[model samples]
Target: MKPKKILLMGVSGSGKSLIGSLIAQRLAVPFYDGDDYHPEKNVKKMRQGIPLSDADRQGWLRTLNRLFVNNDEVVIACSALKNEYRETLRQNNEDMIIVFLRGDFDTIWSRHKQRTDHYFNGEDMLKSQFETLVEPTLDEAIFIDITHNAEDVVNAVMRALQN
Candidate 1:
């Protein structure tokens, strides 16, 4: 089967990386972490518990668009919280398939607390992520409930793609 580009999106600590990795592996494609594309200034701001403005993210989104343009098949993990951000990516590549990792606040908070090395603190930015999220409707993207195991989530996404 030909590989497809998949964008795994959600708030911080929502298992985008884990699930995206599994999906990419299953599809035999590369997986890119959108965080890795962020400018140093943006990373620094997040490290300082400062939320990034749309201006702060514009460059990053453009970078992501470049990656999508360059690759024929890949998986990307991005905290595409807003509708506009997702729309920006979609505009760059109409064939892009977005997999939204939807989870409740408590679930994400618990996962955040378990993470140690990441720059974002669950308590400090959870509210901001939640507030920024304009939940994608059925018409917007493929939604996956992330209240289960990572393997299950990946399986669900794959099944959805097949149908």
Candidate 2:
């Protein structure tokens, strides 16, 4: 069966929000951007170029996970940057579909550089994000290249969902 609960996960600049929003809109479901859910303290630390510790992310992860508690159709853009984070999200929702938007440093850096106004800065934090990410294997999630245009990436994710 096509998966319902969805998490579009990737590094900071890997198009999670853009693609997740598009997919959710097409699917006629509510879309949640995980960044908006970060606690103010976490944002403050990130703004000061401090990489958040696992402890710092715990509550936020729980908040996102709670979104899937009993919902049948939902899409969320999150950085599920660690194996544990994904596991936390998948706790009660075993069939949750994870879509990873994969891209290299230079590619992601370029996209981040183009952003005029965003809470998270570039490079330093980008490296931290990559350092934290434990990418899902073939059976764990659907992986798509973020090098493609927005529409194409969304199309790919949609097709993967239908599989």
Q: Against the unseen true structure, what C-alpha lDDT does each candidate score?
A: 0.88, 0.91
RMSD to true structure for each model, in Å = 1.1, 1.0
Residue by residue across 74-158, what tens digits does model 1's lDDT show?
9999999888998778765888888899999999999998998897764768889998899888877899999999889988999
Candidate 1 residue-wise lDDT at 77: 94
* Whole-model alpha-carbon lDDT for candidate 2: 0.91
Worst 10 residues of 2 by lDDT: 1-10
lDDT per residue (tens digit) for residues 29-123 in model 2: 88999999999999999888889999999999999999887578899899998889999999988989899999999999999999976889858
TM-scores, all models, native as reference: 0.96, 0.97
Q: C-alpha displacement of 137 in model 2, angstroms?
A: 1.1
